[model samples]
Target: MSDLSRTPLYDLHVELGAKMVPFAGYEMPVQYKLGVMKEHLHTRDKAGLFDVSHMGQVIVTGTDYAAAAAALETLIPVNIAGLGENRQRYGLFTTPEGGISDDLMLTNRGDHVFLVVNAACKEADIAHLKTLEPAVTVTPITDRALIALQGPASEEVLAALDPKAADMAFMDVATLTLDGAECWVSRSGYTGEDGYEISVPEAAAEALARKLLAHDAVEPIGLGARDSLRLEAGLCLYGHDIDTETTPAEAALSWAIQTVRRIGGAREGGFPGDETILAQLETGAGKTRVGLRPEGRAPMREGVPLFAAEEGGDPIGQITSGGFGPSVEGPVAMGYLPTELTAEGTTVFGELRGRRVPVTVTALPFVPARFKRKPAKVQQA
Candidate 1:
């Protein structure tokens, strides 16, 4: 633990009685005194504050939007050039073989592009960005702290601090002043809830977090509940659900690739592994990721071999992520399964402790998402 890095909120986490643990080379809080179950429930019922400063925040600068977008397009299969200002999109960095290097969120910040990648992949991601031909600048914002205020009541809490926060739609980004501190806020989160990710200077993080926590509906949460929330939400965790060996098609994230980057668009097939990815898109992948619900109380876990329920059957795939979902009130998991068995209601078994645990293939997101989208405009004569 001595070699582990600490976030800007480390002291506050300790002061709040957080159980410290090492994750992605950082000393993070896995749970507070409320424990994982209560924390998970609190976020669902109200709002929860999470210190996600360990994640990477980077800015990509170039001479112009066209050059920067094109340079970024060469790395990922997304329509970066088409993204409007202040709007964000989810994307994945792919290898030449079409496997995912890392999953990320990209936002067009008018003058430059803002990228947020997984903590463990930030270094390599930055290095990869620097290698692009257009001579764009990759600037890592290590002096910033990211806090996620997530849950159904997030808007209420944040709007009190900055009224303009309520005006933003889902996946919208803004630079605002919160209690006089510069804050780069985004109306998005990983918990499948309506929330905001607040990026502020490191020195002001604790104060801002305290102000948010002072809200009657807000509580400090930890990584333990964060994991369960994401699992219930069916969001993928980097390195576990996705890695260098998994492609977007195999990861069930083909939706992230827009049509413009596909076969019949104006700009198509210039990204890494475009050939392999395009082929997979056309012909279908061998194995695809699917959600699983264990029939019994036993929780299926990672590396558990999946098999068909027939006698002397060979393993089909393996579980990548699994856990007990507080919101779902059951054991939920996601893993790779053969395309033939990827349909909902399919039967599968996971080997656990020398016994076969029966599970059913189900649609992802055990819990329904509560994202706040912009209301449709009304027209009158």
Candidate 2:
């Protein structure tokens, strides 16, 4: 099939009648025969299995903990030393000029740090990481398959298969066995829903996937619904909404930067583009990420021009990611605009087709997040 990369569950997906498409050099399913709308609905209602094996799974470890932490701090705003073992942190990769290279998840896997980076940017991330911290052993877990089981029923569905699913806390990771195979299960997801992402050995991925699919609440979803779900959840896609030109301040991700990594403190700054980030954190960034709600039925897409409200003013910001949000039950978009225009109810204009559609600057994650952060009974593996 074009010699592109394939996940361990590719065979199962093909048998399930999925429509395969190329994504980040991997032969991924865009949708099943039932289509994107159905899959999206299924994920919101029940549970959906997404093969995210293309994503980069890596381990960054070193005997020198403090040194390694500082080296990693130089590349991201997160205070690596602060995250406890088995705890995960969200962060961004900035350019030398204070722009985001990509956003990623970092889990302190006890002595070793686990990094799940974007698929397309994996090679570059690894190369850059090596240049930054060559002493740290960064090994890509190519023999693993990443799958996301998401939706309202995700926890119940997974717990039925593995009782351990109900015992892990949010943002925490635990090593467990699934269908007699060693797996790493985390209480995390991208759809703003209660779910888990399972990392399993490639050889057993297909077998586990089959078991999950057999569950009444579980359905095999594709990349198409995954995009819509994340978009509706107001999550940024690396190359699309976030890039070397975007910054944490503008992306509304400043919380990801720890206090130690801030402007002051003995830590100073080690990450790329600290000067710009510090300036923005102090003086405030002119632009910030905001949501938009179109007044009409027409949908405003990415790259559309943005105009300030009141008396038909000048251009301000543009749409980053926009589309009909199935969860929100209407058209919604995430974009950046002047801080003054970021206020809720701030009217804006978007050039839709040949007409300027009136839009209002709204809050993001238009749909409420259903993340299951409920405290679970602590259990040691």
Q: For residues 176-214, could you state the per-residue lDDT of candidate 1 as single tens digits?
A: 788779999999999999999999999999999999999
**Model 2 per-residue lDDT tens digits across residues 189-257:** 898888888999999999999998999888999998998899888888887788888888888888878
Give candidate 2 regions above 4 Å deviation.
1-3, 64-67, 309-314, 374-381
RMSD per prediction, one decimal?
A: 1.4, 3.3
Please name the candidate that would achieve the greatest TM-score relative to the true structure: 1
The local distance difference test score of each candidate is: 0.93, 0.85
**Cα RMSD (Å) between model 1 and the true structure?**
1.4
Show the colliding residue pairs in model 2. 74-270, 74-271
| Candidate 1 Cα outliers beyond 4 Å, as residue runs | 377-381
Point out the worst 10-residue segment of candidate 1 by lDDT: 130-139
Q: Best candidate per lDDT, number?
A: 1
Q: List the residue pairs that clash in candidate 1.
A: none
